[model samples]
Structures are given as C-alpha cells and as structure tokens.
Target: MTTTVRWHSIPELVRDAAERFGDAEAVVDGDTRLTFAELADQVRRTAGAFASAGVGPGDRVALWAPNSAEWMVAAFGLLTAGGVLVPVNTRFRDEEAHDIVVRSGAKALLVQNGFLDREFTGPPGVPVIDLKSDGRHGFLGSGDPLERKVGEDDLADIIFTSGTTGRPKGVMTTHGQTLRLYEEWCDLAQLRAGDRYLIVNPFFHIFGYKAGLVASLIRGATVLPLAVFDVDRVLELVEKERVTVLPGPPTLYHSLLEAGGGRDLSSLRVAVTGSADIPVELVRRITTELPFRHLMTGYGLTEAGTVTASRPGDPYEAVATTVGRPCEGFELRVADDGEVLVRGYGVMRGYLDDPAATAAAIDPDGWLHTGDLGELDAEGRLRIVGRKKDMFIVGGFNAYPAEIEGFLMRHPAVAQAAVIGVPDARLGQVGKAFVVPRAEVSEAELIAWAKERMAGFKVPCHVEFRTELPLNATGKVMKDRLS
Candidate 1:
C-alpha cells in the first residue's frame, strides 16, 4: 500500500499525537520535561504569540539555536502560527549564518545567546529575537485555540542543503510529505510508543528534526535531546533515561564501543546507522558485542528524509551490506551513468528560488537525480557504491571510493577513512586516502593493508594521515577539502 496520512499539516499531526498520548512524557531535555498534553498547549500559546507579533501564514521565520526543549517549542510554535521554519546550522560561522538568514528573506529570527560558546555579534540582517527572552512567552496568545487546518501542499519548512562549491540551496518540503515519509520510516524501523529515544543528531539536520522529534511525537516515544554529542554524556543519558532507540552516525557507535565499557548499555535495543563508507566489520561488532536487539541502517539525503531502511529481521550481513529497499511510494532506479534516481513524496518540491538547478536535479519526467551511485539487487536491497563524482578510473577500471574506503576501514589501525580521485600521469587518475587512525599507524602500513584486501585498481597509491578528518557539523567528511 502507498503511504498515507490522516493529518494534513504539521500542527494537525502534533495535535493527533497529543490527544492520543496525553499526559505521557513527550519531551525531556535535562531538567526540563513536558507531557504531550502540556506540550500541545504550549505550542498553541507560542503560535498565538507569534501571531500577535505579526507572523502570519506563509511568512518565513528563522530559528538559529542548538538542540534544546525551547528549540522544539519554537519550531512547532512557528508551524502552529502557519509560518514556515527556516533552521540555521548552529555551527555555521557568522558569515554563513548571515547569508542564509538574508537569502531566505526571513522576517524574524529566533536566536540563542551563543552557539558553541561564541556569541553572534553585529547585525544579522534581520530582526533577531533572543531565544531565552520573555518575548517568546511574555505576549499571550488569544485564549482561543489556533489549530488552523492546512492542506497537504502547504509549505512546512525550507531546509538549506550545504553545498561545497556554491551557496547552499533551500530545499522545500511540505507537511504532508514529511509526515508520510516518517510514518513509513517509523513503521519500518519499529519505532513504538513508550520507547525512550536519545537523539544525539543535531536538530538542524533532517535526521534529528523529523526522524528524531517528529517521529517520536507520532509514535508516542519519549524524546531526550542531547545538545552536544559527548561520548560520556550519551552513555550517562542512556543509563539514566533507559534509552531504547539510538540512531546516529557510525562515529557515535564507534565511540560507544571504545568508551562504553562497563556501562549499563543493556537498555539499548535498537541501533540505526548509515553512510556510504559503512564497514561490514563495524556492523558485525555491533551485533556481536553490543546488546542491541535490532541493528538497522538507512540511506537518505537532504532532499529526501529516509528513502530506504533495513528491516528488523534482515540478516546481519544484509543489514550491514545494503541500505534495504525503498520506502512505500518511493521508486528507486539506477541511471545509465550509474547515478541513483528516485521519485516519491519524500523528494523535495524544488530548490527554492533556483529553477535552473531544480530542473537539472529533477528531470521533467519527475525523477530526482540523487548524484549517488548504487546498485539494486533482485531482492530489492540497495548497495550504495559511491558518489558518481567520487568514482576514479584506474587503468581503465572504474573504482568507487566507498568500496576502497570500506576495505581500508577493515584494518585494525584505521578508525576513519575518505578516498578521493587525484590526477595521475600513468593511470590518468588514481585514488588518494585521507585516513584518521585509531592509533599510531604508518601510512605505509595502511597502504600495504589495503593492497592485501582489495584489488589493485581500488588500492590508494598515496595515503595521508590526519589527526581528525575535516567533517561538517553533520559528521560527513568534507571530501572537497581533501581534493
């Protein structure tokens, strides 16, 4: 059956959850806790205050803050007022932050005092509203409830995708599309009511915002937000809150294995991880050593929330190997050039204010060119090969960097690795490895290790060691910098 939803907009979706799970713990952030019923009430009030402040339907409001309970209230508050939310990366430099706020034409901004301990001084080109101020709460909403119903196509949020070469593009998503995709994601991932979720992913990212908070609301799970990702803090929260579901990047799980010794990790029942360079060895250790009952991985991008996910009962090898079949209403097919293309509700409507780029991304036929290269098997599972741009030709053979990076990670000394194609005189092009070592390991040894495991074409001729690979806030290695 195709994906379907009863709620038309985000406010309605939240209202349904609040009514069904009234009085249940909806959110927990350190000392601040709110039940579903109370949370719903606050949302209406916040919306009323926004309305009082002149925010109306279709207005764009910027929210620049780290993960906190207030962030949740502010986000839903904007939606409740029929305003579109524009989330800013908490780690963005002042210049980057200014560009997004100005480019999106944000009417007002809800900003924190400081992010990562650095205060944002000077003009931000918009009316900046302090998050900790009474301004958000002092003004009272009309006593009348404002749960205005909206259509499925109503603009919910405009999330900017960070591009390396140029300015970020705002990807537009509607309320109905997001709700439907997560409904499939939650159902396939077995997210249930009463499950304690420890969300370490940043809220600005779709994984944390939709998959973390919105999914919890839909499934009636308790959300425990982590402002910062500290290994010790994650362990402490997991133990204290009895977190049952934790989904994060591979680095999160890697740290857990390294530092989680002797901790009460038995409460961890579900673990979800995904990336192009996921190693089978990591998946093996997670299943064998970790106490998680279900280990799954998924594949998605900023344009699409979660297009595919591994099933709960999938074989451990398959779970580690592929990013499972497409979610309902989503169709995945590889292009002749080996690029992955998908068409579904989860795909963003368009790139805001950039029709030429949108036309390039989503063809007239409606297939969204994903730029990712992958292969789908007869059983419908998809094995992500690598980025189409990252594939290198070695001695006339096409060698995907992800395949080689995964092989290099199997080495005991290698903790993280990224491979980029560098120009070569003899082979026309060759692979170079930028590696983050687990310990003091020589590049010579790592190159020798890769030679033994992978084919000659896939082996990196050059290896460079980094103390820590340059990563964006969302944990993806900045391959452009390496190149």
Candidate 2:
C-alpha cells in the first residue's frame, strides 16, 4: 500500500509507523533493542528537548556520532522538530569538524563522547549535547509538543563530501527529496514489514542515513546498528538477528568474506554492495563462499542520492557488471562526452549557498551533472567508467584510470590497484599504477598481465608495490596521494 503522508515531513511517517508496528523490533544494537513505539516516543521527547533548547525550523542541528541508536533518535528528532540535520563524518579530524560546523551554521551539536580511540569535539560556539550522557536518555521520558511546519522545499540535511582536492562543500538536500528517494528505494528493493536489515555503513554517510535508517523505518523493517566495522561481529549479528538485507560497500563485503572463512551465514538472503564498483572476482567469491542467494550493487552520489541499484533477482553478471538502472522517479543519461547525468526528485537543491559551483553541477535544464563518466547499455544499465575529473590525457588520447584499475583487479595476484597520470616527457603524461598484491606478486608479473589484457598506452609505464593503498574515510582509494 502506498503511504499518503506529505513527503517533506517526517513526523507524520513516524506517527504512522509507530501506530502500525508498535511492537515490532525497530532498532537493535548489541543488547539494545527499541520497538517502533519506543523509538517514536524517544524521538518525540528528543524533539521536545531540542525545541526547549531554542532549536527551531530551518536551524541546523549537527550530529557528530557513529552508528548507534542515539544517532538515529537524534536525527529523527531534529527532523521531526523541523530542524535541519547536518551529519558530520565520524572520521573528520578536529580542524575538519570545526570547519564543517562553522560553514553549516549549526546552532546545536549532538556528539558521542568517543569511539575507536577517537574523541569528538563539538563545533566551537555551538551548544554541545552529549549523546552518551546518562541524562540524555532521560530526555525522551516526557513529551514536548512538536511544531511541525516543514515544507517540501525546506532543507532537511547538509552532507559534506570528502574533500580530496579541496575544502568539502555541504550538499543541501530537501525533506521532500530524501523522503521520495527512500520511497523509491523501498519499492525497488522490495523492502517490507518483515525485512530485517543490518547497517554497518556509518550513519554520517548519506548511504547509511537514507537507505539503512530512513528506509527501514518507513518500511516497518528492523535495523541492526553497529558503531564500527567489525566483520566477525557483523557475521554474528546477521546470523543471530536473521538479517535479511545487507547493504554496504565492496570493502565491507570483502572483509565479511574474509572473516566468514568457515562460518555459517545461511540467515543472510540478500547482499547489497556499492558506493564503488566491486571486482568481478570478489563477486564470484561471495557467491561461491556465502549462503546468500542474491548479490546486488548500487550507485549514487551525496548530491543525487542513490539513483541506480541492481535488484536481488538480477543475474550474477548484472550484479558484477553494472550498477543497475535508474531508481524510480530518476532518469539517467550519458552526455556526448560520456559523463553521467541524472534528473530526479532525489537531486539536491544545490550546494549550500554556493551558486557558482551549483551552476557548474546542476545545469539550467534541471539535470545534475554527475562528474562520473559512464556508458549506458541497451538494457539501460550504467557501467561507470571513471570520474570525469580523474581522467587524464595520454599522448592526446583520454585515459580513464578507473578502466585501467578495473582491468588490473582481474589479475589473480592483484589485491587492489590504483592508476594515476604522471608527467612523461615523451607521451606528455603516462599512467602509473600503485598496486597492493594479495601475497607476493612481482611488479613485472603484474605488468605482463596488464600488457596481455590492455593496450600498451593503457598499461602502466611504472608500477609500485605497496602493502596497502591510501584510502579516505569512505574507503575510496586516494589517487592524489599516490601521485
């Protein structure tokens, strides 16, 4: 049945879910489990406290925490109270968090005391509320009347992209946009009341915030939240909780496979991996090693939301090859130059207050110019080639590093690979590969493998073997550092 609540407002959905599935398990963390009724009540109380603290509509309330029940409650509370939510990356250093808070103009900040040996400090000048305070849980004991007047156009969140090249810009998403995107995802993934989901992705990320928390709540499903990525812990939770849906990036899945070893994972039914492409060999290993029947992949950006995802029933090749088709209400196109573009309700209003960058990103025709290059097949599936900005010219021919990396990953000995363009006096710029081998593969062997598969220019001119590749918080390889 289709939900009728206004897409822009979240409290309405919370009210409905609580009424419909009050007794169903809503959130689970270790020994902590909160039913829909309990979760909704807590959200109401949290919203009330925030309101009492002078937080109002359009005001930004920053949440700097890991994946936990409190994070979910704070997020919902802020939205229910008509306050904009700004989720800070848990991996952000002190200076980064300070800059984000100042840039977003958040008046209130909710943060965990510490996690994984990292301490989080609230943005200076903003009132800091401790999520772990014993008294913090008591704030949900009483009701505070909510002043819910948020409109479809009202800003709901400001998600900061990892600033690899420069300062991170906050992508402004509206309530209507996020709600609509979740609705589409639920329909596409066939999420229902009985579904049990395992959330390992950080809540600070749009992928986890939208797909894991918001989608589960709206669909009447159960969410199992984890504070950090622990493969063994994840396996235990999946089996114990009977988790039906598993959504994470390729690295998470790879780790899970490694940790599984000989463990039984029969309870897991669908494994959804994305955020970045997965190696074909890894896909094969998951199918052969795990009890999961359906392995899917999804594609999205912080600005456009999750627009493409392979369904559970898709073929193995489709799951490994493409990032599926456009999600409901979203349209995908390949520009003449091969850049991917999307137009949908999920697209952000624009980068917060940065008109020049916004203009460069979203064209006047309403299409969001995804900087990623890709190709659309006859079946409409999108195969991401690489980032547009990451492309480099080699002897007058455009060289996409992701293509080279994808090919290299097929080699049996290559564990991970990243390609970057380095200055060459002869070819203007030649590709250099930084590789991490699984065991002890030599650079000469890998180069021969690439030469056998790719063109001479596409193959690496020089190779460097390292124990590990540098990555950002999101697990994406940092090519800039390699150069």
Candidate 3:
C-alpha cells in the first residue's frame, strides 16, 4: 500500500520545531547553548541583516565557515530571508573557492576570519561578512524580523559536490526537498526529541546539513557543534554533554577508536557514519571497543539528499556490508549498465541552470542517474560497489576499484588504500593500488595479500606505498588525481 507524504518548507519546519520545543536547548558549542526560541530569534535577526543588505529570494549567498553556530544561523537566515544558500567546502583552496563563487554567482559570502591556520579572502566583487571578529561574535545578533515570502519549491542551498574530475557544479536543493529529507531521515533513524546529537562533519556537505542540523532541529533534538574533529575532544564532549547521537565519516570512527584508548563511551547510544564505505573491520571494532551498540553506515550524494541508510535494529552485516534500503519516498533501481538510479522528491532540481549537466544527470522521466554503480539484493538492500566512472575494464573483465580497496583495507597493517586504473599496454587499463600502512609493510607483502584473496587481474599491477593518499575536503580518496 502506498501513502501520500506531507511536505513542508524549510522555514515552516523550523517554525514548527521552535513552537514545539521553545525552551529546549537547541544548539551547544563550547560553553554557548541556544534554546529553540533563541535559535529562532537568531535566525530571524540574521535574516533581517541579510534583507537590509539587499539579499532576497533567489539570490545565492555562500557560506565558507567551519562547523559553528554562526554557520547554522547563516544557513537558516538565508533561507528565512528567501535567499539561496551556497555552502563552500572549508578545505577548498582560494582558486577552488573563487571558481565556485563565480560559477554560482553568489552575491555575498559568510566566512570565519580564519580556521586551522588558513585565512579566507572574500571572493572578488562579492561582499563577505565575517562570523568572528576580534574574539567578538559577528553577524547573527538581535535585529528586527524581515518581511519575506518563500514557498516549498523555493531554492534552499546549492551544495557543490567534490569534483573528482573537474570544477564542482552546484546542486540545487529546494525547501521541499530538504524538509522531506529531514522527515525521512527522522523516521528512518527513529529520532526523538530527547536525543542529543554531536556533529563533527562540516556543515557544507549535505550529510551534515541534513543529518546533523535539519534532522536535530526538526526533531527537537540538541546539536553540539565542533569546528574541527579532535578525537580526544569528541570523546570528552560525548562524556560531558552525554551526547547520545554521533554522526561523521568513517575516518572519524577510526580516529575515535585510536583516541578512545579505553575511555568511557557508554553515553553514546547511536553512531552514524557516511561519505565513504565503512570497513567491516571498523564496524566490528566499534561494537567491540566502544560502549555504543547501535552503529550505522549510510549512503548519500549532494544531489540526491540521503537516499539509503541502515537502521540500528538491522543485522550487523546489513549495517556493515550494505547501504540499507532506499529511504522513504525514494525508489532505487539498477540500470542495465549497473548504475544506481533514484526517483524522489529528495532528488535535486537540475544542476542550478546548467542545462547540459542537468540533461546528462537527470532523465526526462525525473530519474536521477547517480554515478555510483551498485546492485540490489533479493531483500531489496542496495550494495554500492563503486563509482561507474571509477570502474575500469581489465582484459574485457569489469573491475571495481572500491572492491579491491575494500579487500586491501581488510589487512590489519593497512591504514588506508586507494585503487585507481593506470594505463596498461597489456590490459588497456589495469588496476593500481596505493596504500598507507599502519606499520612497515612492503609493496610485495600487500601484493601477495591481495593476490591470495582476489583474482589475478583484480590484483594490483603495482602497489605504491605512501605516507598518505590525496584526500578531498570530505576525506574521500581522490582516485582521479592519483593516476
């Protein structure tokens, strides 16, 4: 039986949350905590300031700050003022940032003065408002509300995906799309008003924005923000705030395991990880070492919101091996070429006016051709093998690099591994492996380890040992740059 889903705009969701949980602690960072009422007030004030600055509906306002309360306020403020928010990756270089701003045509930007020794210069011709100045808060202060009108179909944010090949394109998300995403996530994760969430992922990415910010706000949960990922500090926050929910990438889990060092993690009731595959070994380690029994791994793209997620009550294997079923209001299918196709409200509204890209990505029937390659099991769970563009043909055989990398990660000595296709005269294109070892392990050792488990062609033609692999802002290995 099918059921009709009710949709609300982003501002309406925020209004509902504030009205329902007005006095509840909505956000916490360091020593600062803002109640739901106060959070709404800040959003309105920031919106007023933006309106005064002449930002209105449909104008793109970019935010290039780390995980801070101001970032959240700026995002919501832009939405409240009917402005479109464009989130820039904090790890982007000046050139990358400049390219995004110019391509997106952002009228203004909001950024921190500096983060992690990196100072930001505002994009050319675009006014930049700093969030912090001389240790005093900047922007988001109390002000009068701005009279604005927005609908569910209005644009909310333009999140740029990590461009593995070339320049990043902005993925437009509508207010309705974001609201449906938050509600779907809340229902799938069984979120409750009593939950306290700790967010380590950057707010720029959809994973953190929807899962970390919108999910918590809509559910009347508290959000504890961290500007950076400090393994020790994260553990301390979990203990101090009694943080109930934890969300981040797989690297965070690995770091937490190393930093945990027998620290008490009983307060952590749920841990959600995404942005890359969660190694089964890491899943096992978390359950064995950490006090949290509910560990989950999910899948999402900037364009598709979060389509697939594993639930806490599912089997450990499901959470470890598969990306779970598609979230509610979404349909998933495997194309003839093995690409994952999605159709849902959560799918983005074309690539922000790039007709060529929009036509290439979404079909006429509204099916978004997710570049990731995967297959559905008999139980309807989706197992992501690798990116379609990353797949290479070896001697007329298909080789998925992610599968090979996953095999390499199984070795106890390997810290991280990236598999890429290097041009080979014999096979046209063959797989090559680059590894970062936990200890001193030679290429010969890794080659032998992989050969034993995988077919000869699937084995790395050559293994290169490196101190580290080149990772994008979100920490995913940049396979395209390796070769």
Candidate 3 on 270-367: residue-level lDDT in tens? 77775445567777777777777576667889888888888758888777778898888789999999999999878888786688998999999889
Residue pairs with colliding backbones in model 3 are none
**Alpha-carbon runs more than 4 Å astray in model 3:** 1-7, 134-138
The local distance difference test score of each candidate is 0.85, 0.81, 0.81
Q: Which portions of model 2 miss their true places by more than 4 Å? A: 1-8, 134-147
Count: clashes, candidate 2: 0
Higher TM-score: candidate 1 or 3? 1
Models ranked on lDDT: 1, 2, 3
Error (Å) of candidate 1 at residue 467 is 2.4
lDDT of 2 by residue, 338-454 (tens): 989999777888888789989998999999998889988889998888888788888998888878887888887777788889999999999899987876788788888889998
TM-score of each: 0.96, 0.94, 0.94
Which 10-residue window of candidate 2 scores lowest in summed lDDT? 134-143
Pull out the clashing pairs in model 1: none
Overall local distance difference test of candidate 3? 0.81
